[model samples]
Target: MNIPSDLKYTKSHEWIRVEGNVGTAGITDFAQQELGDIVFVEAPAQGSAVAAGAPMGSVESVKAVSEINAPASGTVSAVNADLTDHPELLNADPYGKGWILKITFANTGELSGLMDAAAYAAYVAESAH
Candidate 1:
Protein backbone atom coordinates (compact mmCIF):
# COMPACT_ATOMS: atom_id res chain seq x y z
CA MET A 1 0.00 0.00 0.00
CA ASN A 2 3.00 2.33 0.30
CA ILE A 3 2.94 3.29 -3.33
CA PRO A 4 5.38 6.16 -3.72
CA SER A 5 4.33 8.84 -6.14
CA ASP A 6 7.63 8.85 -8.02
CA LEU A 7 7.40 5.27 -9.24
CA LYS A 8 5.45 3.54 -11.98
CA TYR A 9 3.76 0.14 -11.74
CA THR A 10 3.03 -2.90 -13.79
CA LYS A 11 -0.23 -4.83 -13.62
CA SER A 12 1.70 -7.76 -12.20
CA HIS A 13 2.46 -5.69 -9.05
CA GLU A 14 6.06 -4.78 -9.71
CA TRP A 15 7.29 -1.24 -9.10
CA ILE A 16 9.82 0.47 -11.34
CA ARG A 17 11.81 3.46 -10.22
CA VAL A 18 13.12 4.96 -13.40
CA GLU A 19 16.38 6.91 -13.37
CA GLY A 20 17.15 7.96 -16.90
CA ASN A 21 17.54 4.83 -19.01
CA VAL A 22 18.35 2.68 -15.96
CA GLY A 23 15.75 1.48 -13.49
CA THR A 24 15.34 -0.26 -10.19
CA ALA A 25 12.55 -2.84 -9.96
CA GLY A 26 10.84 -4.41 -7.00
CA ILE A 27 7.61 -6.02 -5.94
CA THR A 28 5.18 -3.47 -4.55
CA ASP A 29 4.44 -3.52 -0.84
CA PHE A 30 0.83 -4.43 -1.61
CA ALA A 31 2.10 -7.36 -3.61
CA GLN A 32 4.27 -8.78 -0.85
CA GLN A 33 1.44 -8.41 1.61
CA GLU A 34 -0.92 -10.39 -0.58
CA LEU A 35 1.71 -13.03 -1.26
CA GLY A 36 2.35 -13.52 2.45
CA ASP A 37 5.67 -14.48 4.07
CA ILE A 38 8.34 -14.79 1.39
CA VAL A 39 10.75 -17.68 1.83
CA PHE A 40 12.77 -17.69 -1.38
CA VAL A 41 13.42 -15.74 -4.55
CA GLU A 42 14.69 -16.61 -8.01
CA ALA A 43 16.49 -13.56 -9.40
CA PRO A 44 17.72 -13.03 -12.92
CA ALA A 45 21.40 -13.51 -13.53
CA GLN A 46 23.50 -10.39 -13.71
CA GLY A 47 23.67 -9.18 -17.32
CA SER A 48 20.76 -11.33 -18.41
CA ALA A 49 18.87 -9.78 -21.29
CA VAL A 50 15.15 -9.69 -20.49
CA ALA A 51 12.19 -8.54 -22.51
CA ALA A 52 9.13 -6.56 -21.51
CA GLY A 53 6.53 -8.64 -19.64
CA ALA A 54 8.80 -11.66 -19.53
CA PRO A 55 9.25 -13.81 -16.46
CA MET A 56 12.45 -12.50 -14.90
CA GLY A 57 12.26 -14.62 -11.79
CA SER A 58 9.90 -16.07 -9.18
CA VAL A 59 9.21 -15.71 -5.50
CA GLU A 60 8.13 -18.38 -3.04
CA SER A 61 6.00 -17.48 -0.09
CA VAL A 62 4.47 -19.57 2.62
CA LYS A 63 1.19 -19.66 0.74
CA ALA A 64 2.38 -20.13 -2.84
CA VAL A 65 4.89 -19.43 -5.56
CA SER A 66 4.62 -16.36 -7.77
CA GLU A 67 6.47 -15.20 -10.85
CA ILE A 68 8.00 -11.73 -10.93
CA ASN A 69 7.68 -10.24 -14.36
CA ALA A 70 9.64 -7.47 -15.99
CA PRO A 71 7.91 -4.11 -15.87
CA ALA A 72 9.48 -3.06 -19.15
CA SER A 73 11.90 -4.45 -21.72
CA GLY A 74 15.52 -4.28 -20.56
CA THR A 75 18.68 -6.17 -19.81
CA VAL A 76 19.13 -7.28 -16.20
CA SER A 77 22.12 -5.22 -15.18
CA ALA A 78 22.21 -6.23 -11.55
CA VAL A 79 20.58 -8.65 -9.13
CA ASN A 80 20.24 -8.07 -5.41
CA ALA A 81 22.57 -10.73 -4.08
CA ASP A 82 21.27 -10.28 -0.56
CA LEU A 83 17.93 -11.89 -1.39
CA THR A 84 19.47 -15.32 -1.79
CA ASP A 85 20.40 -15.16 1.89
CA HIS A 86 17.42 -13.15 3.08
CA PRO A 87 14.28 -13.43 1.06
CA GLU A 88 12.30 -11.93 3.92
CA LEU A 89 13.76 -8.60 2.82
CA LEU A 90 10.88 -8.50 0.35
CA ASN A 91 8.45 -8.36 3.24
CA ALA A 92 10.55 -6.21 5.53
CA ASP A 93 11.79 -3.56 3.12
CA PRO A 94 10.24 -4.08 -0.27
CA TYR A 95 10.87 -0.62 -1.57
CA GLY A 96 14.31 -0.09 -0.17
CA LYS A 97 16.74 -2.83 0.70
CA GLY A 98 14.65 -5.43 -1.09
CA TRP A 99 14.71 -4.15 -4.65
CA ILE A 100 14.65 -7.14 -7.05
CA LEU A 101 16.47 -5.98 -10.12
CA LYS A 102 18.36 -3.13 -11.73
CA ILE A 103 17.76 -3.06 -15.44
CA THR A 104 19.18 -1.02 -18.29
CA PHE A 105 16.77 0.27 -20.90
CA ALA A 106 15.95 -1.60 -24.06
CA ASN A 107 12.64 -0.01 -25.01
CA THR A 108 11.55 3.40 -23.76
CA GLY A 109 8.16 3.13 -25.45
CA GLU A 110 7.13 0.33 -23.09
CA LEU A 111 7.04 2.86 -20.30
CA SER A 112 3.98 4.55 -21.74
CA GLY A 113 1.87 1.54 -20.83
CA LEU A 114 2.92 1.53 -17.15
CA MET A 115 0.70 3.04 -14.48
CA ASP A 116 1.68 5.95 -12.33
CA ALA A 117 1.52 5.43 -8.59
CA ALA A 118 -1.88 7.02 -8.20
CA ALA A 119 -3.33 5.04 -11.07
CA TYR A 120 -1.82 1.83 -9.79
CA ALA A 121 -3.25 2.43 -6.33
CA ALA A 122 -6.70 2.74 -7.83
CA TYR A 123 -6.11 -0.33 -9.94
CA VAL A 124 -5.19 -2.39 -6.89
CA ALA A 125 -8.10 -1.09 -4.92
CA GLU A 126 -10.55 -2.03 -7.64
CA SER A 127 -9.01 -5.45 -8.12
CA ALA A 128 -9.05 -6.20 -4.38
CA HIS A 129 -12.79 -5.82 -4.34
Candidate 2:
Protein backbone atom coordinates (compact mmCIF):
# COMPACT_ATOMS: atom_id res chain seq x y z
CA MET A 1 0.00 0.00 0.00
CA ASN A 2 1.16 3.59 -0.68
CA ILE A 3 1.07 4.96 2.81
CA PRO A 4 2.81 8.33 2.64
CA SER A 5 4.83 8.96 5.78
CA ASP A 6 3.55 12.51 6.32
CA LEU A 7 -0.11 11.64 6.70
CA LYS A 8 -2.03 10.51 9.75
CA TYR A 9 -4.33 7.47 9.53
CA THR A 10 -7.45 6.21 11.18
CA LYS A 11 -8.25 2.58 12.03
CA SER A 12 -11.10 2.81 9.49
CA HIS A 13 -8.58 3.37 6.65
CA GLU A 14 -8.89 7.08 6.04
CA TRP A 15 -5.83 9.31 5.87
CA ILE A 16 -5.56 13.01 6.56
CA ARG A 17 -2.89 15.54 5.70
CA VAL A 18 -2.97 18.29 8.23
CA GLU A 19 -1.83 21.80 7.30
CA GLY A 20 -2.11 24.18 10.19
CA ASN A 21 -5.62 23.78 11.65
CA VAL A 22 -7.04 22.54 8.36
CA GLY A 23 -6.95 18.94 7.20
CA THR A 24 -7.40 17.36 3.79
CA ALA A 25 -8.69 13.80 3.91
CA GLY A 26 -9.37 10.75 1.80
CA ILE A 27 -9.53 6.96 1.94
CA THR A 28 -6.17 5.19 1.92
CA ASP A 29 -4.69 3.19 -0.94
CA PHE A 30 -5.55 0.03 0.99
CA ALA A 31 -9.17 1.09 1.20
CA GLN A 32 -9.50 1.90 -2.49
CA GLN A 33 -8.01 -1.45 -3.40
CA GLU A 34 -10.49 -3.26 -1.18
CA LEU A 35 -13.43 -1.22 -2.44
CA GLY A 36 -12.77 -2.03 -6.09
CA ASP A 37 -13.66 0.53 -8.79
CA ILE A 38 -15.21 3.51 -7.11
CA VAL A 39 -18.35 4.79 -8.87
CA PHE A 40 -19.71 7.42 -6.55
CA VAL A 41 -18.67 9.61 -3.65
CA GLU A 42 -21.20 11.25 -1.35
CA ALA A 43 -19.20 13.96 0.31
CA PRO A 44 -20.34 15.91 3.29
CA ALA A 45 -21.84 19.32 2.58
CA GLN A 46 -19.62 22.37 2.92
CA GLY A 47 -19.95 24.31 6.19
CA SER A 48 -21.34 21.31 8.04
CA ALA A 49 -20.15 20.51 11.54
CA VAL A 50 -18.70 17.02 11.84
CA ALA A 51 -17.50 15.27 14.95
CA ALA A 52 -14.47 13.04 15.25
CA GLY A 53 -15.05 9.40 14.30
CA ALA A 54 -18.54 10.04 12.94
CA PRO A 55 -19.83 8.98 9.55
CA MET A 56 -19.25 11.92 7.22
CA GLY A 57 -20.00 10.49 3.81
CA SER A 58 -20.05 7.33 1.70
CA VAL A 59 -18.25 5.92 -1.28
CA GLU A 60 -19.96 3.45 -3.60
CA SER A 61 -17.81 1.02 -5.47
CA VAL A 62 -18.56 -1.70 -7.98
CA LYS A 63 -18.30 -4.19 -5.13
CA ALA A 64 -20.01 -2.35 -2.25
CA VAL A 65 -20.97 0.91 -0.56
CA SER A 66 -18.79 2.04 2.32
CA GLU A 67 -19.37 4.73 4.91
CA ILE A 68 -16.43 7.14 5.29
CA ASN A 69 -15.84 8.33 8.82
CA ALA A 70 -14.30 11.59 9.91
CA PRO A 71 -10.81 11.29 11.41
CA ALA A 72 -11.28 14.43 13.47
CA SER A 73 -13.95 16.97 14.32
CA GLY A 74 -14.27 20.22 12.34
CA THR A 75 -16.35 22.32 9.98
CA VAL A 76 -16.19 21.06 6.43
CA SER A 77 -14.78 23.92 4.39
CA ALA A 78 -14.79 22.32 0.98
CA VAL A 79 -15.79 19.19 -0.94
CA ASN A 80 -14.15 17.93 -4.09
CA ALA A 81 -16.76 18.54 -6.76
CA ASP A 82 -14.63 16.64 -9.24
CA LEU A 83 -15.58 13.36 -7.62
CA THR A 84 -19.12 13.83 -8.81
CA ASP A 85 -17.80 13.50 -12.32
CA HIS A 86 -14.82 11.27 -11.71
CA PRO A 87 -15.10 8.96 -8.78
CA GLU A 88 -12.26 6.96 -10.27
CA LEU A 89 -9.91 9.53 -8.81
CA LEU A 90 -10.35 7.82 -5.46
CA ASN A 91 -8.83 4.69 -6.93
CA ALA A 92 -6.35 6.47 -9.17
CA ASP A 93 -4.87 9.07 -6.79
CA PRO A 94 -6.44 8.73 -3.38
CA TYR A 95 -3.74 10.63 -1.58
CA GLY A 96 -3.73 13.49 -4.01
CA LYS A 97 -6.65 14.56 -6.18
CA GLY A 98 -8.99 12.03 -4.57
CA TRP A 99 -9.29 14.00 -1.35
CA ILE A 100 -12.94 14.11 -0.28
CA LEU A 101 -13.10 17.15 1.95
CA LYS A 102 -11.14 19.84 3.73
CA ILE A 103 -12.00 20.72 7.28
CA THR A 104 -11.03 23.58 9.59
CA PHE A 105 -10.28 21.62 12.75
CA ALA A 106 -12.22 22.12 15.93
CA ASN A 107 -9.53 20.59 18.09
CA THR A 108 -6.00 19.91 16.95
CA GLY A 109 -5.40 17.83 20.06
CA GLU A 110 -7.46 14.99 18.57
CA LEU A 111 -4.62 14.51 16.11
CA SER A 112 -2.63 12.73 18.81
CA GLY A 113 -5.04 9.81 18.51
CA LEU A 114 -4.24 9.19 14.85
CA MET A 115 -1.58 6.84 13.51
CA ASP A 116 1.47 7.75 11.51
CA ALA A 117 2.19 6.02 8.18
CA ALA A 118 4.30 3.20 9.66
CA ALA A 119 1.72 2.39 12.30
CA TYR A 120 -1.02 2.31 9.72
CA ALA A 121 0.96 0.04 7.41
CA ALA A 122 1.45 -2.36 10.30
CA TYR A 123 -2.23 -2.15 11.17
CA VAL A 124 -3.19 -3.01 7.63
CA ALA A 125 -0.85 -5.95 7.67
CA GLU A 126 -2.33 -7.26 10.89
CA SER A 127 -5.89 -6.88 9.61
CA ALA A 128 -5.15 -8.83 6.43
CA HIS A 129 -4.62 -11.93 8.50
Write the residue-wise lDDT of candidate 1 on 49-82 in tens digits.
8887889899999989999999988888889999
In order, the Cα lDDT scores of the candidates are 0.93, 0.96
**Model 1: C-alpha RMSD to truth?**
0.7
Error of 1 at 39 (Å): 0.6
Worst 10 residues of 1 by lDDT: 47-56
lDDT over C-alpha atoms for residue 112 of model 1: 89
Residue runs of model 1 more than 4 Å from their true location after superposition? none
Clashes of each: 0, 0
Task: Count backbone clashes in candidate 2.
Answer: 0
Model 2 vs. true fold: TM: 0.99
Cα lDDT of candidate 1 equals 0.93
User: Candidate 2 — worst ten consecutive residues by lDDT sum?
Assistant: 43-52
